[model samples]
Target chain A: MSEVDVVRSSSMADEHVIEQAPQSGTGELDALAAALRDGQPSAVEGIYDEYGGLVYTIALRFLDSPERAEELVQEVFLAMWERRASFDPMRGTLKSWLCTMVRSRALDMLRADRRRPRPAYSLDSADGDRPAMEIPDPSRASDPAAVVETRAVLSALDILPDDQRETIELMYLAGLSHSELSGVLGIPLGTVKGRVRLAFAKLRQHLGIHLEVES
Target chain B: MTTCAEWEEEYLESLAAGSGPSLEVLAHMESCPQCHLLLQKDRQIHDALKEGVRVVPPPAALKSRVLSSIQTSPSAPQLHVMTEGSSPARSSRQLHRGSILIARLAAAAVILLASGISAVNLARSSSVTNAAVALQLPGEPVTYGIVQVHPASGIAYLANASLPAPTPIEGHASEYELWYIPSGGVPIPKGALVEGPDGQWHGAVRYPVQGSGLIAITVEPAPGTMKPTSLPIAAARV
Candidate 1:
């Protein structure tokens, strides 16, 4: 047909080969990370193929909107490319770091959305002066068994009492520190510490995990 | 001795973050198998959660968008220069509005003075006689609409169409400092401008022109003082 169509056809052929290649390995992620650090163009495709689903899922979890989640996924990768130089291998694995980045971006988007006009008072404003309150979404709580199992580690948090669960979700999922949570939840400092401790203990029990306490 | 509960919380946080404890904590855990077992379980849980998390691919168009944005965006040096004067600042009003026009007129004046025959006395009497010649700061690209310098007047203008607005420096009695950084040179302090009660400010500084450079702004304690303790609010090159 035309030159544009020719180029598109060629690219489609190339993508077909890439898609057919094994897509479930960490090797691809490590390679993509290396390529991105080295500023290679092909790394973008590799990264998208490997991590797009995870990033999109995390964004969808927080925003609950496909369009917004898609937009954020793009923004997250764009940021990754822009700030690739700052990626430190020593800090943690690239995947963990990427997860942290995606989560932070999603949380930021959530906060911005809360600031926009809404019919009801935002949970954020209600808990602004208190330690953060975790409002469990019944829908997410009642997810399919597979989805629950997939997120089973998080379910250990469900073993916690409501107050402890509130503290743990605020600290873990929302990335708030103890002091900030105290402010948002309007709880005494001691109470916050107690709840966090109890929550960790319950999580440890539910997950059959043990934590070494340092003297 | 660290309490079981206190250490437990820290351990959980560390595992969630995929980081090991300090050497001291590690040594303790080594001597205490009970704690070591706990740490192992935590790691297992963390790993499982990580595996369960799905990896999402970036959109098909992201690569092109990122590549094009980087290519079309002005170079960093130019951006740095532009941010200096681009703030909706009122203090540098004179400098921002007519910096280029002044530079052109000054260059023309310098040329006429250099040609010499008829206007030596006229040039000598001109107030703009000591105008500084704009020097391109080191490490800056020679890009147009990025930085303009007028040495005679000791003014550097930056084109900052892309820089974001400075966060509102709320409250009373606050000052912001501007620095002119030459290539490979230390930042030279340009004086301070005050922000009004409405958290708005506008002004320019008259510092001894050291070299052609980028402009940087930092918020500081009041009275238009010299040294800057806070991070720069905005920056641009001239």
Candidate 2:
């Protein structure tokens, strides 16, 4: 069999928290990658069965459109199937790696279109009044764990200082870099970094989950 | 470049930048556990946040399209396995010795460094400890660590511990495996505890925990066994 992990994360309302837990183990990842590399039957399908939904969800969120997300899903899987030899579970979980690639690719698409994804709800702007993010998938809110984890992250972001909140929203959701964020926000690079540091510090203390949102 | 205290600002700067640790910083982290923990924490936090935004489930057609698309795509060239009839992951493992070596060296260095600090602390405490909470260590507990997990998230951690390897091996990094004892279910081996710079073990389980369960720890050699070879030295009933 491939690999699966036994990592379960709950809200900080209980014990500590885990971010994204991979569904498979290192040996499992290695096996999956190897099988895909050798073009074994159902190997690609097996991967899709595991993480297809996750990949599509991330693509949709970043690309802000279903058509693009669909296209991205196919593109990403094909690339992984072809580049299977390069995947090393030792680097990180297949989940983490896929998430990173999908986000980066979606951002690349956004940049090519010269557009940016609008947040569902603006966490920072003065009015702080904006339309919420629309996820056409009503079934998404069905999973209790996913709901809790999503709420926890949003809640953490909600509590950050407006500046800090905005800093991460743009950096994370938009995949903007420190320098890019500085230019867009018209703030100094040091100031941008300060907000990121303070925001993550709060995230670690408040939710026990966090990281720098970089492109 | 210099002292950890000196590296602190540079570390955070790079961390926030998402540029990853530089060679100098990594070289420094080779000796510092705090920096190492910070790095893992940073990545986990980022991963969690990224995961948060991706809660939407995919449509059925997406999976169908992906499945069918592969039918038309070119297949990977079939190559003979170097060793006859080895497993898939094992075959790949044999193919990329360089990558495996680099990863092993990095992990070993981190765990070795972590054992010096976090493991030492656990050895001294032997009691439940951590910002979250510690798992109970049975059988007189040598260098047992704390465990903190979210109920449904399958997010478990062996916060701090350093114990001698059960194997007769010498001077090698010690790896303790975590197990999910689902109430009365069969013991499932999760993964080996990889020590962060802070000397705590960090990793995830494959799926979510449904009801009551117990997470325990056992020391197993590499490649892994179907079951736990030794009784648990660390355990926490949830």
Chain B TM-scores per candidate, in order, are 0.28, 0.38
Clashes of each: 44, 27
Deviation (Å) of B157 in candidate 2: 43
Tens digits of per-residue lDDT for model 1 on B65-152? Answer: 3332232222211111222433333245434433333234333323433433211211112111111112222243321112222344
lDDT winner? 2
Candidate 1 regions with alpha-carbon error over 4 angstroms: A1-30, A90-92, A115-198, A203-215, B6-238
TM-score of each: 0.33, 0.36
TM-score of chain A of each: 0.47, 0.50
DockQ of every candidate = 0.08, 0.12
lDDT of each: 0.44, 0.51
The i-RMS of every model, in angstroms, reads 18.8, 20.6
Kept native contacts, as fractions per model, are 0.18, 0.25
Off by over 4 Å in 2: A1-22, A88-93, A119-196, A201-215, B1-54, B76-238
